[model samples]
Target: MCSGIEHGSCRVSDDGRLVWAHVVLGPEEDWQECRVVLDARDGRELARLPLDGAASGSHHMSHPDGLHMGLCVGMGQDGILLHWARRDGEELTGRDLDESSDRILMDVHPGHPGFLTVEHHGADLTLHALDGTVLAEGVPEPSDEEDPPRWDHSCGFVDADTVIASTVESDEDPDRPLHWMLDARTLRVRDAVVYPTGRVRGHVRPLGDGTWLTYDDGSGTLDRWTVATASA
Candidate 1:
């Protein structure tokens, strides 16, 4: 196993050939850090990318090409920064996609040249081009309750054209987190995604294709889902 890896910050490339994570150096109190890329199968070291004095959060998304990535860095009460760098550890850059402190790097579009970000505890989402252009911003419509549902931390791309997002599970509707199907470019609500009884409750993992994976916290069971009908 690779040493000194920040487990929560690890992510695999879309092609499944490489794995990368934030590497903590020296003692735990030192907090000095770098990013290490490794071959997924054999755990061979590929490269070490520098943090350059920036603090990274637990989340990051790698480019589909496996050569570049966006890291959640500069985390603070003001906001988080999207730090960009290549596998070779060169040409580092950072972008403040949104000013919200809760903002995080979501999934990168598998086929398209954009990525997704959520802020304000999932009240809002933004689609950004690879060059940091704001392609679109989407906010969930408030429910009748005084406080809106806030379950979108698991949001991600379902396909190039579709996005999967969720609302916070309501106390009145326990075990039933409503998932929405959205238009990728416009962020328009298309429909609700309904699953069978075998469905799970954890984060949704989109596999680039039309399928996704979910897990049940209570049972520790995992399930893969696909549409069953034209409307689904």
Candidate 2:
């Protein structure tokens, strides 16, 4: 259904069943806005939700429960909007979440009640409940040195209770990026993650099975990582 028309990014739900994207509803001269949800398994058109006066966003996400969706609108502006919608009796009802900062929803928790978000400029991170309630917020502590690491937008939950995040200053070398482990609920620094030799780079992408994934630029291969347990 997204043929020969203006369409935004398409996001798939955590279950891999639902896919959605915002599209222009009419001709260029008098186009409106709407979101089209599709069934991923069979490529069938599922629902079309009208978006009156709603601006499209760069980042979109389908809720884990498969009943709702979220959009991060107006990025790079002085203020950003977090819009969410859910099907209500054949109609999609939505609202912009009331947030005090301009942040972007980077990742949603797997098998949990909260989602992860980072500041628009990647300065801080916050965890929020499914209903937009703030659960925890913080950034890693700066080290006692001339140049401390800055948190980037590459962050997500490593599991149900732990989050994996990275820090690489804009002017710094990407090969020397640092990563951290944080308590998902409290946003507290749990530890600084250190990888084995030659596998020390790449942003973190949680696989939701206690292991995470990373890509190596030099080798051009994806790597899976998990905490090594000590012998008894």
Candidate 3:
């Protein structure tokens, strides 16, 4: 019986057995928050932990194992606070990843022990371990097409060896939207993914099963794409 909260934001666990929601404490203006872990089967409260000193968070993403998670307090270039979380049955604990306050909670790599974030205003994308270890980091080369292509705020792992990264479209070059396939380990530009329908997506979700899903907003449909090999 959860009640009396101004708002609640939830995300289903990767295993599909539980749900995690950030239950905001009243008068969100005061900057208090709680993370509630609930059972998916019956919506039972498995655990709840209070977050101190966090005014608000943009979104929450669960680790593929369903035992850990990361959340960004603010979104975009305004993002400053990112938190790492873990739980054991009815017990949950969380803390800030680093004191630096420079992280954007982009997406968690499916089946990997780390998550992804854009650093220095998308100048580089980095992979981080749950405890905040920089696993890998890379920046795209200056686009030969655009004078200087900027990394879009959206990106995610296509597989263990590849990452589907994006470049935002500009009013001057709206038709130049691109999905770059970056070598996961080196973060080097490998190739461009020719979206079957030529639609640009804001996000790409890596399904643990060697495939990923892309949504076409124009047609309101979802298309699953296979992770491409460097040769293919």
Candidate 4:
């Protein structure tokens, strides 16, 4: 196990040479500081970049070409900040995602170019493109007669046409009971899957053969399901 004490958020760079880790180095009450550390091949620190402000929900997505990385920065009470990083002559240069709406950014799709999904006021969900354009926006519908649609926290894409999102009925219980798979091209809920485990943080990724790999954080295991069966 790596003993550097990483705070949960981590990403493996496309080059596979470094592991970008997001760390919080302060008390819980205070603003959580954010920084990225480049771990060398020998398990040693190579470089560190401290962010401008403290970030709450920190997520990372690498560029398709793997030469650049996108850092999704979320403020506890304020909103979200998108940071772009690229190699600058042996150094990494970064900047803000844009100068427009700074709502609480929830998650980003790994396969889409400049595609961002955000949550605001804890209930509203919106999708954004690379140029900060709103691609799609809506409120999740109630899952059942007893449970009404409430809030969703995270999302990931399985391919160019599909996205899996987490949904809950209330803030008191954030564990998503239903995993929704939406059509990216249509921005409509195509199907819903009842997780065998209770509320969990899960991500959907394609496996190249009409299959998907669902990583359920709550269960600490991976579940492979065919798109056809998962949708049915």
Query: Which numbered prediction scores highest in lDDT against the true structure?
Result: 2
For residues 137-160, what per-residue lDDT tens digits would candidate 4 score against the true structure?
Answer: 656755555656744555556666
TM-score of 1: 0.72
lDDT per residue (tens digit) for residues 46-145 in model 1: 7775554435345677777566777775444445656656654433334444443456787876686788877746777788876677788876646676
lDDT of each: 0.67, 0.70, 0.68, 0.59
Tens digits of per-residue lDDT, candidate 3, 28-119, equal: 34644678788899999888888654333457877776678766666333346687777875689887877574768777665566678886
Candidate 2's residue-wise lDDT over 1-232, tens digit each?
A: 3323323667887677777777667766676666777779987777777654444345697667777788776533336667787766555677666755777877775477888888776767888877788888977667555766677768887778888888865225544436778887898887777666532666778776777887767678777788762000
Q: For model 3, what is the error of residue 47's alpha carbon versus the real structure, in angstroms, after optimal superposition?
A: 3.2
- What's each prediction's TM-score? 0.72, 0.78, 0.73, 0.62
Regions of model 2 farther than 4 Å from truth:
1-7, 12-19, 38-57, 74-79, 145-148, 170-177, 229-232
Report the error of model 3 at residue 143, Å.
Answer: 3.8
State the RMSD for candidate 2: 4.3
Candidate 1 pairs with clashing backbones: 151-168
After best superposition, candidate 1 residue 185: deviation in angstroms?
Answer: 1.0
Q: Cα RMSD (Å) per model? A: 4.6, 4.3, 4.5, 6.4
Better of 1 and 4 by lDDT: 1
Candidate 4 ranges beyond 4 A from true positions: 1-10, 19-39, 42-50, 98-111, 120-122, 142-148, 170-177, 191-222
